[model samples]
Target chain A: MAKNEIKYLTAIKADKRVKKFCRFKKYKIRYIDYKDVEFLKKFLNEQGKLLPRRLSGNSLKFQRKVSDAVKKARQMSLLPYVTDLLK
Target chain B: MQLLQDLKLLIIILLKMELSAITGFLLAITNNQKSFKNDPLSLGLNSYLCRPKSVFADSFRTMRNVHWDKPPSQMLWRINRILNLPAIAFAKAGLKQKGKMNNYELMVIFTPVLSDDEFKAEQKKYAKLITDAGGSIVAENPWGLKSLAYPIQKKTTGLYWVLQYTAASDFNEKLKIQLLRDEAALRHLCTKLDKYAVEYNARKKSGAKTGTEKLAEV
Candidate 1:
């Protein structure tokens, strides 16, 4: 019974992750271009902060790609360093 | 994860609605539901709104423990996002905007020492070049002299000019060569405008409030 319960718990964990699939993999996107500021905003919060990899469900490789792109976009002024939307 | 994001968005919308608050609707609640307990219309908001306890101390909990009597259903939220509905979902979320032209947005930083006449003449030269190349200029905005975030060629500031035009797919290479040959421009970038960027540019041109959300590019 103990073994069965552990198996059941793992099932639930898998079920939880099923919904959080990595979008880059789904879209088959080979490159995450920083020029697409509009797309990069998905990885940022309203306050212009980068969302965590876990929350966004980004794979490790793609998450690094996103961070690099976001930083580049920020430098290019295509995206903002800080957004004062609240003010 | 999307549910959490949506709940946070709902709370934010509710927070904003408080400004012209008339009637109270069923609002989703975060754990620290103290502020809105009473007549939230009067805005008894304090710590809980900006700085909730636990996990965080200086901001709203965002998506944590947001419970409401009549919460937006998960399926409905997903559908709403897919449809790219306004207010929350960040203007259509993941879905691509429909009917976008193949347009490119170009930004060039010219040496700041150029006189106004020189700048206009140079701008006209590019405009004519674009027209001659079977492309049409959609919009032009001269940002004037602006300081850069860092020094380029030891200069602290440069004249910024922006242009949006639709061109052939392979035309970018030709344009790049032209820009590379032009010594007057300190820096330049040409990006194909996606549907969202197109929508954003149109909205901004309409003089809407959303334009202020992005900061002035330094």
Candidate 2:
């Protein structure tokens, strides 16, 4: 039974897909800027909320930068906090 | 062997307790719920949560049907002030220096009611103001009659003008006072540009499409 459990665990681990690449790194973006609203929108959901790193597949540092940029964009009125019903 | 097993179990239990404690602490900090509750000024959270379901439903229904015919009554000036607090603080700290020439980008939204002649005159007046202050206008783009995201001073649309210039550090104070005194100017934002920003704007103006041009194309 233990042998079967170990085999199953190894199989699960082997089948799990790892996200080792970051979008910002791939694009060679040095800083996540608020002015780039189009680029920033990719990191947001339909509700205008910042997606979690797990879902967005962003590195920890890049995610922090993106969130900060999004907040600044919101403050500047470059982006909306919520999508109004009237669109 | 039993004693060793017991020791291992105890260590595991302690580790589990510590992990849980750390997770709770992290959750508290990340959610910011405790801070929101503690803050006296935050009407958003408590009001949103404690409001009656009927009231919530009514607002949601109204929100869906609402049109832009009537401007939103709440000006939210306090919210605007709060949002601009960091910029204001930075300006206060940086404004002590007097004769340093710096690049600045200014966007002024004029009341849309102005006639074409008055608009031209107003533009000339500001252009003269920059020259009189010993500053040179690098680029000027007049983005005429664009709909605002939200109405300002009950005006649905505004005549947007963007000016990039190099001026003395002290010139911004005078410019701000003038803008504030002008009733025709609905809204204005002045941002000091760094070396990189100046280069980017120059490049953009020379060949690349300006933001308004891109919008126009769309």
Candidate 3:
């Protein structure tokens, strides 16, 4: 606990930007469709893995739907189960 | 006394808004509503709500190898039997959803070598196959020559046709067999649509655009 370190901590600032919200809830979407490939892709990373709820800005309820849709899309070949980084 | 209290809590939840729909679905199936019985859950929940004790006893009888030497373990086993009622019903329902028409959607990729007339005829033939088998086609969308996300059968592009239909649970097997026999089909997938999916597809066809669909236009 140095006095000089306390002075340096004053540079920290609170973020004022708007927080992320669940897109499905904002739009009142009751269903997540696997056939809607482009929409499902938004919830996947470059490696084609499902993005976590924290990263995707989705709530727990909507996150479940998203994961279910992603898996179904993979099964139907609407989306890749995995992708190469180069691709 | 604890069991009664738990049932009371369950009843209160059933009466509330959160589970009313689920309770209503259960009640409808219990009443033997034909249309509602299409969902596999309806059967399980039906038996569960109407005669849980009978199912519990039957299922427990099948699992009867548990040693009855200890009284405390026997008491715990009784509790476990009560907890397994819904699970047993669901297991049985999952296996036998026959003679019930439920929502289904089929997607097929036809080889790109087909002529325009051939494509039309092929789509019509499949549609007829569904109707002739006592099922109804809700919508038939021909996406027409879309590039595959990955190479399928060494082809980079395919004719994508999607069909939404309601049929008995076993009917998809017959459709899959037919698709396999048809040399023109490159790939095929048939999926069972839950209630939400049925509503979503209906809404999509009714000109209510989903978010991605609107973005696709731009």
Worst 10 residues of 1 chain B by lDDT: B50-59
* lDDT tens readout by residue for model 1, B49-115: 3222222211222332343222324322433344444433322232232222378988888998999
For candidate 2, the TM-score is: 0.50
Order of the predicted models by TM-score, top scorer first: 3, 2, 1
lDDT at position A37, candidate 1: 70
Give a tens-digit lDDT track for model 2, residues B138-211.
Answer: 99988788776556788778897888999988898999999999999987878788775676676667887433
DockQ scores of all models, one per candidate: 0.01, 0.02, 0.25
Model 3 Cα lDDT, one tens digit per residue, B1-218: 33443354355445553433356333542433344324445433434433323323332222222222334234333333545443344344332222458899888999888989999999999999999988999999999998776777788788989999998777888898999999999888888888878878888899786554542332
| iRMS values for every prediction | 8.9, 6.7, 3.1
In candidate 3, stretches whose alpha carbon ends up further than 4 angstroms from where it belongs are A1-6, A16-21, A84-87, B1-99, B211-218
> Ten consecutive residues with minimal summed lDDT in candidate 1 chain A?
A6-15
**If ranked by DockQ, best first, what sequence of candidates would result?**
3, 2, 1
The DockQ score of candidate 2 comes to: 0.02
Candidate 1: true interface contacts recovered: 0.00
Candidate 1 residue pairs that clash? B84-B92
